[model samples]
Target: MELQKTILKDCFILKPNVFKDERGLFYETYNQNVFEKTTGLKVDFVQDNQSVSSKGTLRGLHFQNGEMAQAKLVRVVRGSVMDVVIDIRKNSETFGKSFSIVLDDVEHLQLFVPRGFAHGFITLSQQSIFSYKCDNYYDKASESGIIYNDATLGLDWHLPEEEFIISEKDLELPTFEEAVS
Candidate 1:
């Protein structure tokens, strides 16, 4: 696997080795040992989640609090998406900063989002199968989110605000300033 570090603290873009032939193609989606050695972080993903999003769908800027925070291994399986992450670790140098990447079926790249970061994604294709492995299980009481278009955060998701399809819950999320405060 080829791992590329992002500007955000502890985030990574992983390009797994793919072997192709006349028949089809093959790749190791996850190898615990290689992942641990390459990223130098030991994680045990207990829950695997998958979501199918249509074009223009926006989901996220979400994370769990305290011990419930999830470390995710994320990627696209069937189409494409503009995946995003925000550094919410209060004492970290990159706090309140963000990272974005285009993860698609063609390139087969995966992103590693450590605990303490908020994550979200918007589909850039007709439809996308977004999959992720989370180190922790669901925790509703600790769940929270930042508004996707928080003015202070100033993230450009490459989509017009009017064109996005967001959930009412997401619409009710706190702004960047409120979240960080």
Candidate 2:
């Protein structure tokens, strides 16, 4: 696998070395030794989560606070999505900046989202299966988020506002200013 940096600080895109033949295709999704050697990051994933969403569905701009913050390695298992992240680390140079990438089964690309960022995705295909590995376990009390359509973020979700299918919980998320405060 090759690790490539994104515009966002400490974030990366992993391109796997795929082997193809008449039989089919294969690739190593994750190798702890190689990952640590390649990126110099020491992460012990404690939780694995997956979600299936239909086109127009939007989730996130979410994160955990303080000690419960999580670093994530995310990928698409089937279909496609526009995965996005915003730097929220108060001391980082990229704070308040956002980055986005298309994740799909065809490319088999994975994104490494460091702690101190808000993460989310919008499904672009008929149905998509998203998977992620989190370095820390989840804590309900520590969970928080910025609203997906917060004016300050100015995110281009690539779908019309009327097309979005959002949860009531996500609709009620705080704004970027409120989140950082």
Candidate 3:
């Protein structure tokens, strides 16, 4: 496994060395030693979550506060998606900045988002099956989110506006300025 750092501190893109043959293919999706060696952080994933979304569906810009903050290992297993992560840590230099990548079954790549960021994705295929491992469990009281289309963040989702779809909860999420103030 090879871990490449993103613009945001501690965020990473992990590419597994896949071996293919006439029969099939094999790869180590997660190896603790390599993960720790590359990122220099020990994460013990406690929960696994999976979701399926149709093309144009957007799910987040979500995170938790305090002890419920989570670090996520995210990947798309069935189709493709435009995965995004935003730096929300008030104390960090990159606060309010965002990073994005296209994750698909063909690449089999995974994204590691540290605890202090907001995470989300938009499906780009007919249907996308997304899975992730989280270092912390879900805590409703600690849950928070930023609006996906917040002007200040200025994320280019690369999807047609007419096709974009978001839930009422997501649409009601606070903006970066709203959250800070």
Best by lDDT: 2
Per-candidate TM vs. native? 0.98, 0.98, 0.96
Write down the lDDT of every candidate, Cα atoms only. 0.93, 0.95, 0.91
59-112, model 3: which lDDT tens digit per residue?
998999999999999998899999999988889988878899999999999999
For residues 30-123, what per-residue lDDT tens digits would candidate 2 score against the true structure?
A: 8999889888999999999999999999999899999999999999999999999999999999999999999999999999999999999999
Screening candidate 2 with a backbone cut-off below 3 angstroms (N, C-alpha, C), the clashing residue pairs are none
User: Model 3: which ten-residue window has the lowest total lDDT?
Assistant: 27-36
lDDT of 1 by residue, 67-170 (tens): 89999999999999999999999999999999999999999999999999999999989999999999999899999999998888889888788879999999
Query: Which pairs clash in the backbone of model 3?
Result: none
Model 1 spans > 4 angstroms off: none
Instruction: Report the backbone clash tally of model 2.
Output: 0
